[model samples]
Target: MSFSAFRILAEALTGHGGWKPMWREPEPQARYDIVIIGGGGHGLATAYYLAKEHGLTNIAVVEKGWLGSGNIGRNTTIIRSNYMLPGNEPFYELSMRLWEGLEQDFNYNAMVSQRGVLNLCHSDAQRDAYVRRGNAMIMAGADAELLDTDGVRAMYPFLDFANARFPVKGGLLQRRGGTARHDAVAWGYARGADMRGVDILQNCEVTGFLIEDGQCNGVETTRGTIRAGKVASCAAGSSSRVLEKAGLRLPIESHVLQAFVSEGLKPVIDGVITFGAGHFYISQSDKGGLVFGGDIDGYNSYAQRGNLPVIEDVCEGGMALMPAIGRARLLRAWGGVMDMSMDGSPIIDRTPVNNLFINAGWCYGGFKATPASGWCYAHLLATGKPHPVAAQMRLDRFERGLAIDEKGAGPQPNLH
Candidate 1:
């Protein structure tokens, strides 16, 4: 049922018992026109857009676990289009635009908060670099503003601006960029897709692919054999393992990226902030907890747990940026397996196997790129062509010598 103010009032008047589950838990069907692997944000969004935008509803989004139980639920919830590269900027801008109208379009309260995102610059060189990045953001139709030390101080007065080692020189601010409720995004997509006649199959793991004569027509799952006209894998961290079953080795390495939240405090950080000297970023949740994260683990692994060194490194960065943060007690932390591509960019393209598509290698940008990723993937699956904004996110970009290395961190997954 659609949620509305009248419904709430009626439910409240009637003892508040009219609420129902967001989406149904349907059993897997034998066949579908399109089968999407993984029930995370991208998969559910692909199914939703395929039905809403492309008018194709015979889709199945199969998941190994409960819905939103992946990177979609394990993130700092930041969203922005502050990219510098042409290959990445436009696509993220599209995602940012989509995020602006997502809750209204899907009729759900995903909490798309545009509280702004500030990227601090610790040195003159970093400030100059942020100036260039801000220009690029403006060029891509995204909002950006270069903020001096005083401007940044006006926003976040508690920052360690006097640190001699890494003094805060300036920052790049995206007035329209901010955070969202990550799990609610997944739920809204799932509910929208299900309402439009797309099947969401949870707890049904894809064991293998139904490939014959170099074409994939279905998948072999833990439940049973399911046939499909086309199969798309949006498996995130499990991309390599899932495609390995089809004998396709990806250039993606799996690394665990950890995130943390602190004990509740009075409102402090009104917007997202990133430390320039290090890879730490943080924002305060509506519930008063300070949510933050840092770089991925240095090693390659599929386990959704992080090492201590990375945690220490992240905490150090946080303390370095805001000395007062050291006083807050750490409440808890969690990790998500990141599919880091060689050049630290995502890949969304048709694989070598006919009728089989792949959407993986999102690295650290997956959560922010959810809407555009799904929109582009659905466009590709429906039209057999890449969306204009996502044309550079091909699986063979590295082979074609066209890697979109956003960080200029070379081809190392650990560095990006």
Candidate 2:
């Protein structure tokens, strides 16, 4: 049932009893044209685009848990196209445009707010770097503006401008970048995919890949054997684990990235803010809570919980940026496993196993890249070629000594 104003009015007239489950909970089928592993935003989006854009509806999005159970739900919900690198800029800009019309396209309220995102600079070097990044963003067809210290202070007076250490020199602002409702994005895509005849099979964990003659044909799941013409994995932190079942070891490390939200208070932050002196970034939600996060835990593990050291470090960064943050009581926090790649960039290319595509190594940019990631992955799965914007995200880039190290931190998962 499509949601509309008339439907709401009719349901209201009928005592609001006409509502139904957003998507069907289907069991696994014997075979399908495409079987997507992991039911997070990317998988559901792949299924949705495969049906909506590629005209392939006989698809299955198999998930181990419920929708929005992974990084899609665990992120800070920030979205932007302020990337300066060519390998990453165009793809993210496409995603930013897609986010602009996502709700209208899917007929759901995902709350894609473009309140803007500001990256503060504490040093002259950082200000110069942001100037270059802003120029690059303009060249990539994304909006960006450089704000000096007075301009930033005029916008946000709560910041600690007088701090001798990490003084706010300037900031790079992307007026088009902001946060969205993370969980709603997953549900919207899932519902849209279901409406297009894609099967969303929850609780159906992939046990292994069905490989024959060096070609992947399907998957072995907890439910049963499912055959498919092709299979794709967007398992996020579990990307390596899923590929290992097929004896494919990826150059990806799994680390827990934690996020936090404070207790509700009066409106404070007008938009997203990042501290240049450290890794902390924050934004206020519509519900009055300040949502924030920082660097990933400095370790390699699959656990979804984080360590205290990281939490303490994140809080310190917050305090260094805005001393007033200490007055707000901490509400809660959670962690999502990150698939950190060697070059700190993502991969959206076919794996060594023919007929098996892989989408992994998103690092810290997964949430922001959801739409274009799915679009590109679907394009590749449907046509057996990489999308132009995502052509550089090949799995063999590292082996070929041409990694897209966005952070300039050479081959360090924890650093990125």
Candidate 3:
């Protein structure tokens, strides 16, 4: 049902009992025009755009488990387009624009908040780097502002501006950057796709790909053998294992990235903030919990849990930035397996196997780039051509030395 003010009022008057399930639970079909692996944000978004933009509803989104059970529901929910690289900035800008209109487009309340994101700089060198990055963001038609120490203090008075090692010198602010309700994004996309007649198959694990003579015909699933004209893999951290069934080895590594939420407290943070000297970033949830995360575990693993050393490190960074955060008791923490590419950038392109496409290597940007990733992947699957903004995200970029290393961290997956 379409949600609106009138609908709410009607439900309120009628004892609030008219709500329905967001999406349908359909059994796997024997055949489809396309089969998309994984039912997270990217896969659901792909199915939505494929039906909405390409008029192809004969699609199946095959998920191993329940919807929104992956990284889509396990992130810090931050979103932004403040990038610097020519290969990365424009694509993220498109994502930012898509996020701006996503809730309206899907007819759901995804809570796409634009409360702004501030990246604090701790030294003169960092300030200069932020200035250059801010200039690049402006050049790419994205909003950015460089704030001095005084300016940052004006916005957040509680920050430890005089830290002994990492004193706050300035900051780079993106006024349009903020967070969203992660599960709602998945639900909205799932509902939109279902409304358009796409089959969403949950609890159906894909065992292998139905590959024959260098062409992908469909997938072999636990439920049954399904045939399709094209098969796409949007599995984030499981990309390598999923594609390996087709005899393809991806240049990707899976690492666990943990996120934490503190006990409910009075609203203290109005926007997202990141530590320049470290990877810690935080934002206050509407429920008043301080949600935050830091670097990924420095290892490869498929499990959805992390060790304690990284947790201690993240807390240290948070304490270093805002000494007051130490008093807030930790409520809970969870982990998401990140698909880190060699160059720390994502890949959304066709593979050597014909009729097979892959969208993985998102690292820490998956949740933020959900809409654009789906939009671009849908464009590629529909027309067999890379979307203009995502053309550089080809699978062969590494061999050609065209890596979009936004972090300039070389070819190390852990560092990115």
Q: Write the per-residue lDDT of candidate 1 for residues 210-272, one digit (tens) a residue.
A: 999999999999989999999999999999999999999998899999999999999999999
| Residue 27 in candidate 1, Cα distance off native in Å | 2.1
* Candidate No. with top lDDT: 3
- Could you tell me which 10 consecutive residues in candidate 1 have the lowest summed lDDT? 16-25
List candidate 3 segments past 4 Å from native.
none
Write model 2 residue lDDT over 144-257, tens digit each, in one string.
999999999988999999888889998999999999999999999999999999999998999998999999999999999999999999999999999999888898999999
Candidate RMSDs in Å, in order, are 0.8, 0.9, 0.7
Query: Tens digits of per-residue lDDT for model 3 on 116-180?
Result: 99999999999999999999999999999999999999999999999999999989999999999
lDDT of 3 at 379: 98
Tell me the TM-score of each prediction against the true structure: 0.99, 0.99, 0.99
Write down the TM-score for model 3. Answer: 0.99
Rank the candidate models, highest lDDT first. 3, 1, 2
